[model samples]
Structures are given as C-alpha cells and as structure tokens.
Target: MSLIILASLVFLLMPIFLLLYIRSYNRHKKNHFLEKLNMQQKFESEMLQTRVEVQDQTMQSIATELHDNVGQLLSLTTLTLNSVNLNDAEKAKKKIDNSLSLVNKSIKELRELAKLLHGEQLVENGIGHAIHQEINWLNKTGAYELKINNQLLDVQVTSPDKDLIILRLLQEIINNIIKHAQAKHIQIDSYLEKNALHLRVRDNGVGFDPNEIKVKKSGMGLNSIYKRIEMINGKLALNSAPGEGTSISIEIPYP
Candidate 1:
C-alpha cells in the first residue's frame, strides 16, 4: 500500500513539474518578444527625433544664409537702383547694369537656397552630392580656406538615415569650428574603404583637450555626435591639442 501511494504521488508530481516548465518557457518567450518590440520602438523614436533635429538645423542655416548673404545682395541692389540717375543715360545705364548684375547674383543665390530647402531630399540623392552642396554653401561665406577630397562622389550606395545623421554630424562640427575654433583653414576628406565609409575633417583651430571635455561633460555637441555615431554602430576618433589643430575622423559601415 505504501509503495503504491508513493508511485501515485510520483506520477502526479511529474505532470505538475512538466506544466510548470512549460509555463516558465512560455513566459520567457513572451518577455523576450516584448523586449524586442520595446527596443524597436525606441530605435524608431530616436530616428524620428534625429530627423527633426536635422530639419531644424537646416532651417537655421537657411535663415542665416538669407539674412547674411542673399539679403545683403538684394539690399545692395536696391540701394544701387535707388541712387540711379534716370535722366543721365550713361550713368543710369552703368548703375542699371550694376543692379542687374546684383539681381542676377541674388537670383542665383535664391536658387541655391531653394536646393538647401530640399535638404531632406539629400538622402535620396546621395551623401556625396549633399555634402558637396553643403561645402559650396559654406564656401560662399569666404571665411575659411577649404581643401576637400571627396572620393565617394561617383560611388552609388545608399543608407538614408545614416546619411542624414552623417550630414548633421558634419554640420555640427563645422558650426563648432565657426563659432569657437577661430580657425582659418578647414580640410575635409571622405571616401569608402574595406566596406566602410570614412570622413575626416581637420581644422587649424584653437584646439581643446578632448579628455577634459569628456571628464567635464562640457562638449554637448561632441556628446551628441558620439551618441548618434553609437546609434549607427559607428566610431569616431578625435585628435586635438591646445595651440595645435584638431582632426576628427569618423568610420561607419556601408550600406
């Protein structure tokens, strides 16, 4: 009787143990599925945020160019027109000619701005052209001497989101140089190698200690660059020293 009772309990407990094991497995699978879903959602949210920030920066660039470049050109044209002596044919012709030239320049600038306004389409086009367009706009300022070697111009590879992030990253770096570097020369090189995209930017600027920036957590822009690069599984190398120039190199996997 004792042996029969013991056997019966073992049989009953086996089914219970199996039920518990199945329940635990199902719970684990459900948890894993939820975690993956959450991670995907987070990625999408970050991507959207990055897009908004890029758009905001583009708009700011547009506003600045219009006010500083195109606006000045138009204003000068207006003043020349206002001073024209219509009664004197020769003088009037000269002033009118100058005004026409200015107007034409302004028209060209407006056309460039129109292209900038389509900044989002940049990804659709390709990173190389978009970068060239940006460099052209920066050159218009005539503030810095730029040496550029962009080898990716003819290469056809697409990574839309990464391209936008890369553009924003370059813009941030340029803005930092413009605002604080007090530099006179900028060098940019971009190319593809070993299935990786590389961008290198160097500036003869009043450099700072990268270690200090990291320790103090003071380089907000730098932090953003690192964060975005990490998001894209990319890497950044920064070389800088006080009284020496700064150089930044970014490496990212290709599409």
Candidate 2:
C-alpha cells in the first residue's frame, strides 16, 4: 500500500513538472521573438535615417555648386551683358557674342546640376551609373587624382537600399578626406566576388591611428559608417597609418 501511494505521487508530479517546463519554454520563445522583432524595427529606423542624411548632404552640395560654379558663371554673364554699349556696333557685337557663349556654358552646367538634383533617380538607374555619377561630381573638384576600377558597371543586379547605403558611405568617406585627409590621390575599386559585393576606397591622405579614433570616438564619420554597415549585414575593414594613407573596404552579400 505504501509503494502504491509513492507511485501515485510520482505520477501526479510528472504532469506538473511537464507543465512548468512548457510554460518556461513558451516564455523564452516569446522573449526571443520580441528581440528579433525589435532588431528588425531598429534596422528599418536606421535605414530611413541614413536616407534622409544622404539627401540632405546632396542638397547641401547642390547649393554649394550653384553658388560657386553655375552661379558664378551666370553672374559673369550678367556683368558682360551689362558692360555692352549699344553705341558701338562692333564692340557691342563682340560683347554680345561673348555673352552668348557664357550663357551657353551656364546652360550646360545647369544640365549637369539637374542630373545631381535627382539623387534618387541616380540609384534607380543602377548602382554602377550612380557610382559613376558620384565620382564624376567629385572629379569636378579637381582636388585629387582618382583611379577607378568598377567591375560592377555592366553587371546589372538591383539592390536599391544597399545601393543608397553604399553611395552614402562613399560620400561620407569622401567628406572625411576633404575635411581631414590632406592627401592628393584616391583609388576606388568595386566588384563581385563569391556571391558578395565588394567596394574599396583608398586615399593617400593624412591618416590617424584607428585605435586612437576608436578611443576618441571621432573623425571620418566612423560611427555612422559602422552603424550603416551593421544595418545592412555588411563588414568594413579600415586600414590607415599616420603618414601612409587610409583604405576602407566593404563587403556585402549580394542579390
């Protein structure tokens, strides 16, 4: 009779133990699910923020180009027109011809600026062309010698979000070079390798110690670049030294 009673107790406790185990497992599963959902939401938020920052930077660039390049050209044309004297036909003809030429140059510049104005449309065309457009704009500055090796140009694979992020990354890198790096030569290489897309930008600029930058938590938009790369499930390798230069390489899984 005692043995029977002990067996009954064991049987009763078995269900209770199983119920407790299941409840604990269910709670853990719920917590895991919530964590994944939160990470997804955070990624989406970062992507949106990056998009806005890139557009704002583009607009600022446009304003500067207009004021410095096209605007200056137009202002010169105005001054030339104002100086024209209708009293002297020969002199007036010469000034008019010069003004016409200036106006034509301004129109050409405006057309180029128009291309820049449609920043989103650039990515829509394709990442290759978008990249070419960016390099072209930077080349206009004539500040550095650029060596470009773009293997993805003719290879048509569309990843719009990644493209924008990559473009912005390039912009930030370039901005850093302009602001801090006093180097003169830049090389950019992009290609596909082992089902992954790779982009590398190197510059012969005054580079600082990466460890120092990490400790200081400043310069070259490093924090922003790392965050964006994380959001896209990409990896970044930065190489730099104090008088040597800086190189940034990014690798991402492709479409």
Candidate 3:
C-alpha cells in the first residue's frame, strides 16, 4: 500500500516538474534573443548617428566655401568692375555705387553665414555657459521670461556622451516650449542628485494628453525623447494637462 502511495505521488509531480523546466528554458531563450536584438539596434543607431555627423560636417564645409570663396570672388569682381574707366563718367559713377552696395550686402550675408558655420560657442565655453547664453538671448528677444537654475555651474561636465545627450535633450525641450507651449514664462533647473543628473524644464502653457499624443502618427518626436532616455538608461517624467502647465523631468545615471 505504501509503494502504491509513492507511485501516485510521483505521477502527480511529473507534469508540474516538466512545466517548470520548460518555463525556465523558454525564459532563457527569450532573454538571449532580446539581448541580440538590442545589440543589433544599438549598432544601427550608432551607424545612423555617424552618418548624420558626416553629413553635418559636409554641409558646414559647403557653407564655408560659399561664404569665403564665392563671397570674396563676388566682392573682388565688383571692385574690378567699378575700377573700369568709361566715356560716360556720370553713368559709370552710378553703376559703381550700385556695385558697391551689392558688395556691402554680400559682406553682410557672409558675416551671417560665418556666424552660423564657425562659432557654436557650445564646445568652447562648455554646455552650461552656452545654455545660459542661449537662454539670455531668448529672453532678450521677446516677451519670454526664462529662469535658469544652475546648481552644477562650477562642476565641470566632461563626459562627451553625457554632454551631447544633455544638450540634445535641452534643445528639444526648448524647441517644444518655443513652438508648442505658447507660454510667457519658462524655467529650467538642473543638479546632481542620488548619483544621477536631474533636470526639469517647465512652462506655463497649455498641455495635451500624453497618451493621446504618443499614439498619433506624428509620434516621432515624443518617441525620440523616450527612446533616447531609454538608450542612456535614464528616466523621464511628464506632467501636463489641458489648460494647465507642462513640466518634463529627466534623470541620467552616473557610471
């Protein structure tokens, strides 16, 4: 009777043991596949970023050539044309004046292109200084009031990946506030907390439902924000509602 009882117990346990074993095996397989997928995706993202950087460098080179070579040639050609001696002296003076005006205009355009192409000011002075300068410039331009809290002002952020990520994140936030927020006031605060960099960008503007907006066809922008944060193993929070304000908080881990 005891032998028969033991046999029944083993029979009852066999299916559960098999099920647990299969579950573990499948979980391991899923995890392995997911790791491979993540690796492939990271490779693709890096490649795309490299391509974009190359394209940007090429564009800057073209812009420089246009301003330096083409613009200088135009100015020199105008001067040479003006130096020409003509029998109609009065008409020649008028034409020379016109050419001089054209040259001056070209110089102005070249100066602007130079500003855009050469001086980023972001790399030289560091990201914090650059952000403050940009915020100051923005505030000076219109009815926009910007408040920047720089807790990490004296602390140098030398991590290239982190620096680029923060800059991109801030740029997107500022662009969103400027384009969509329609707010009179903006606030940005940053500091190091709990072994991570914390940032908040807030504005007194109308807000939308994150759920509704994130699912739309034009969801690329929102997805970009989330994906970038995810790629860096960071955390992001959004606070907003209709007729209320919007605030975005981001936290990037150290090491």
Candidate 4:
C-alpha cells in the first residue's frame, strides 16, 4: 500500500517539475530576445546619429564650393560692370564677352558639381559601372592608383537613393585618402554575395584604428560610410591599422 502511494506521489510531482522547467526556459528565452532587441536598437540609434553628421558635412562642402567659386565669379561680373565706362562700347563689349565666357565656364563646373550631388545615373547602370566611371575620373587626375576587379558582370542593383548613398560614400572615402592617407594603390571590387551586393575598397595607405572613429576628426567620413550602408539596410566592415592599410567592404541587400 505504501509503495502504491509513493508511486502516485511521484507521478504528481513529475508534472510539477516539468512545469517549473518550462517556466524557467520561457524566462531565459524572453531575456535573450530582449537582449537581441536592445542591441539592434542601439545599433540603429548610432547609425542615425552618424547619418545626420555626414549629411550636414556634405551640405557644408557643397555650400563652400558654391561660395568660393560661383559666388566669386558673380561678384567679379558685378565689379566689372560697375568699373567699366559706358562710353567705351566696343571695349566694354569685349570685356563683357570675356566675362560671359568666364561665367559659362563657371556654369559648366557647377553643372558637374550638380551632377555629383544628383547622383545622375546610378540606377540606369549597375554599381560596378558607376564605380568604374568614378575611378576613371580619379585615374585621369593621376592622383591615386585606382583599380577595379569586375565581379558583378550581370548583377544589377538599381535605386537612385542607394546609388547616391554609395557613390557619395566612396567619394568621401577617396577624398579622405587623398587628403589624409596619401594612399598610392587603390583597388575596388564589387560582387554579389548570397542575396546582396558586396563592395570592397582597398588602399595601400597609412591606415588608422577603426576604434578611433569615436575620436578622430576624419572619423566622420568613416561614419558616413557606415550610416549610408545602414540607410540601405546594408552591412559594412572596415579593416585597418596604423601605417598598415585599409579595406572597407559594404553589402547592400536587394531591394
């Protein structure tokens, strides 16, 4: 009779133990999910901050270009009008013609700048060709050694906004290299990885700490790269060390 009672008690306690185990497991899972969610939120917040900073800097750069070049040209045209005597019609006409020519040149340069700001044809062509053209410009300048490895022969990722983000991001990167890194050999590669487009920009230059993105002034550019990627729901990875080299890779999801 005692054995029967003990067996019954054990059967009752088994379900209780199972219930306790399930409750503990649920708690653990909830904590894990919460932790993951918090991390993602933090990452998003940081990315937002970076985007704001980068966009502001880009706008400032454009504003400076306009004031320094276009504004000055306009001011000179005004001064020429004010200084020249009206009695000298032919000479004034000649001066006016010269001023008009200068204005035209300034307009042409401003158009190029506008093209850059607009990200002209990023969607019509794939990112690979777009990058090829940008590097071609850099090559023509003979400022940096720019090489591209074609890996996305038939891949097409098209979006005006994404294109602008990527092109501008690289522009900032190259600008940083020109002004700071003094990089010589720069190789860029673009390919498709899994369900996304991947790009890598490698430079043989004086690289610095990736952690320094927090304190370094040039960190803004790096942060821009990251935020741009994030804006497209992409992924970015940077590898660099002082006096070594830098390789930045970005992966954009297919939209």
Candidate 4 Cα outliers beyond 4 Å, as residue runs: 1-6, 104-172, 183-194, 202-255
Quantify all predictions' global Cα lDDT against the true fold: 0.88, 0.88, 0.69, 0.71
lDDT of 4: 0.71
Count clashing residue pairs in model 4.
0
Q: TM-score of every model?
A: 0.90, 0.91, 0.56, 0.60
lDDT of 3: 0.69
| Candidate 4 residue lDDT tens string, 1-255 | 999999999999999999999999999999999999997787667545544544564466567668876788878877777766769998889778878887897797577556545334533576666576566556745667678886764665566456556666777777877777878899988777777877788898998888767355246367666656765788878888989988888888864
Per-residue C-alpha lDDT of model 3 across residues 13-113, encoded as one tens digit per residue? 99999999999999999999999999878847854663454336435544655766556768676776867679878877776777777777677656644
Ordering by lDDT? 1, 2, 4, 3
By TM-score, the best candidate is 2
Which pairs clash (backbone N, Cα, C closer than 3 Å) in model 1?
none
Model 1 Cα lDDT, one tens digit per residue, 88-114: 999999999999999999999888888
Worst 10 residues of 2 by lDDT: 212-221
What is the overall TM-score of model 4 with all chains considered together? 0.60
Error of 1 at 50 (Å): 1.6
User: Across residues 9-72, which tens digit of lDDT does each residue of candidate 2 receive?
Assistant: 9999999999999999999999999999999898788778878877897788788889988889
